[model samples]
Target: MKESSSFGNLWQAPTARRLAHATSQTSPADSHALGRLIGAAWVVVAYAARGVLRGYLGDSMQSGGGVPFWRCAFGVGMQLGVLPALLAALCASKGGGSPLFPTPRRLERWNEAWLRTPSGVWEWAFGYVFGLFFTFDLLLVPMKTNVLAHHVVCLAFHGWVFFSPQRPGLQLVIAGEAVLEFGTGGSNLSMLLPGSDAVRAFFVLAMSASNTYGAVLTVRWLRLQRGRWVWLTLLPTILGILALRQLHVVNEVYKRAHSPAPP
Candidate 1:
């Protein structure tokens, strides 16, 4: 009896519990708030970038406060939309028998909760952010300020996947994808203007290599998990990635051939 009591006492110490909790996944509120915080941060970055570029050339972007507002809305949308959808899907796995609120803590030492969370909640969020930022940047390729602002925003979120203390390992696959982006346009978050094409082109080659590396790993992992129906999901993902690549190519070609060289 005393041995068990001592064991329980030792294990349940406040520090021990806190340490354990820290290693666990975050609550939805925490995760979502962090997402919004990151989103808002990019707005500040955009404004700062605007000021910096003003000294160099034409007018900086005048978003009329639209960028920050929309970015915040998107940030909140990320968790609210995804979490409940995941909760519903996960609960339905046993024909609607799973717990309504899955525990954030893990029984094992490694924080692998993201994988089992229904609909790949964390994985999907990370990928969604990646796709969202990539598409955002691609759309703004015509405007240097817009392109630079959102690229910084995207890279900020990209680094979050691995560097964040919570569930760092959860999104290694996404990290792999993001790592590829730096080669392409990641490092050039501020490589604005036409003169950057030659430099950007070289980076693109590196980007392509990283993309291929990540894609191979991503597809294999998806297949291992998604099994036969993987194509339903895999096809769109591959096409989208390829499309982003093409967009980059077109942007570089257009900028180089069409826009005047920077002064």
Candidate 2:
């Protein structure tokens, strides 16, 4: 009994008591922080999965009686993800490095941007929505120029997969895409969104301009991680396309509610 009392007194000493107090006081802050971290992670996962499924099945460009292009879109998307993964695995098997975790030399400057990477929610959302819509857009244009225009723009979007949507690069891409579309008559989607051609053009241009200025920056911080971390960097870049079309859906519904009866 006496030994237990001495030990308790030792813990009650000023230094030990302060340490204990600090540890006890940290619990609420730590739990709150952990909760926030989990919430953000959940939101990101939802966005990525949303992007993939929507890319596979969502439709954007069709107006009336258009072919259900999503069926074909699903096939194309499967090819995009599956073919690359399989090829990487096959190459890794032959070379003796795991496909997922590539060698340091193979990935250059991957770790340099880890702190600034996004969770790839917007990018995937952009791709899936664009693919679903553009597939229909391609079908709408009977002329060779329009078809070629759509093809080239979509190809360029795919290329952005390698370039992180670090503000400067993403801004340029959006401006470039809008210009290419307007020049190529791919501005066809401009008309479908509850407005006249002039209004549509204005809206498209405005949205593109806004995105160049507005989309949230992907790099929340500057972190140095391993090179395999580059793959994570590539993701936000790839998935980080404009979410204008998706956001427009909400805007349209809101307009419809307010002006449900247009004479």
Candidate 3:
């Protein structure tokens, strides 16, 4: 018992100690700067991805139902940039002494160094997502009410993470939502290159695989007990439902892509 207690103490800082460290470490400005830097990098990557995809995908890219290649590339850039970071963050947390299952302490440990501190992989992941969605919803594409609502919910949640330091695991919740966003990659690509049924089918299959991964993340997220207030959990639940609606649309698109046409 004494040995276990000694190990536990070494394993994690006390809550008061962690709280003091989180508050005293840095200003929100510093955290936002990290986020902004990450956001700006995604913009640069979007431009680069546009050039790369245009080079590789060629004229198949031109039939995007009036959506430009740049817009399509933003989705691609997000997949290229953000998914890896989220996977890395999850791996780091899981490997770095977090329990395999979701406990309150596990949740706290998952965010502590990565996100609760405001300046590491979680910031990188959130900033990249915020940049991609902000650019797509506000700058690159036409505004749809659904997209706007998801964006607002995310922004609200992001605010919660920054302001409500007591709720460190909120970042993990947002990260799960971000995984759901990554599941849209195939739909985005299919919309962008509507003429290529082969490409569309291939990416849709890829999307199914990604959504399966997201589902695993969601299961873990749902098991977490911390930061489970109605206001805290409600918006993200709505966000996931919205994502399910999009998945339905993507399913319809896939069926259309594969269906027989009139003789």
Candidate 4:
């Protein structure tokens, strides 16, 4: 009986302390409720804005030679609308429950091991050298040019992945698009002017990257937390952006393809 009591105390004491610590660290339930309310409100506003833009500008803006109206609108919705909504949802969902944005445990372990590996050091050195070349290209070249902009953005996003709180998995998708764009020579602005191969590749890569990442992040966030309402508000905005950007790329490609070849 004494041995049984000792064993029970040994395990139960730590469990009790952990529970007490968790309760002390946790935010008030009312605060979480208020956060949800605010998040929902932001989603409503985003939805309304999307409707207005689609209804008023989507059709008429198709006449312009630049990016399609719907695509531009969708970008606005995702960057401005959806991002905020996600942030709000995250705030609402924060507490002692299992973290929605829990750090990837295996990734942490891998990173520790990677740091100790010679190959990892070599890879890091290579990345730094390549990064310097890329940075030089950005600084000296006209990034406003269509080709450069695509590449620069890709590089920038890659850099962002290493430091940002964002998930590496998400960054991998974005970086993969950059790889695809690089392969296609999609960064030439002159091509965009004449709708060249580079231009088509740029648009396709950029639009596809954005759409894919936005959807992936949104879905991941929703699955980890009770935020389907927020995702519902965002999915359309992402799809709209993808469609518009795709159309712009196609139109440009068609125009260039049909134009008279150089004499």
Best by lDDT: 3
Error of 1 at 105 (Å): 18
* Candidate 2 structure quality by residue, lDDT tens digits, 1-263: 11223322433545544543543343434633543454455445445654574577565534321323342333233333433332232222222322123234322222232115522222223333334435433553233453456366566544444244442233223323333333222223333333564655565465554444323222211122225565375435423544533355346445546774657
Greater-TM-score candidate between 1 and 2: 1
> Whose lDDT is higher: candidate 1's or candidate 2's?
1
Off by over 4 Å in 2: 1-118, 139-144, 160-263
Which residues of candidate 3, in runs, are more than 4 Å off? 1-35, 43-69, 82-106, 112-125, 128-132, 195-198, 209-219, 222-236, 239-243, 246-254
As for model 1, its CA RMSD to the true structure in angstroms is: 13.5
* Predicted candidate 4 versus true structure: per-residue lDDT over 5-90, tens digit per residue: 23223324454445434433434444334434544554455456656765765633323333335434544444334433332222
Stretches of model 1 off by over 4 angstroms after superposition:
1-28, 54-112, 115-173, 186-205, 227-229, 236-263
Instruction: Estimate, for each residue in 1-263, the C-alpha lDDT of model 3 and write its tens digit.
Output: 11223322333445434533553354656755655676677677666766676576553422433344555656655654566454444334233332223445656555675453555434444655564665454654544466557566656755655555544455455555555555566667667666786767766666665566555555555454354574366646754765665576676676786788858
Clashing pairs in 3: none
| Candidate ranking (lDDT, best to worst) | 3, 1, 4, 2
Model 3: residue 181 alpha-carbon error in angstroms: 2.7
Q: Is 2 or 3 the stronger prediction by TM-score?
A: 3
Per TM-score, the best of the predicted structures is: 3
Range of the 10 consecutive residues with the lowest summed lDDT in candidate 1: 100-109
Candidate 1, lDDT over the whole model? 0.43
**Superposition error at 218 for model 2 (Å):** 17
Candidate lDDT (C-alpha), each: 0.43, 0.37, 0.54, 0.41
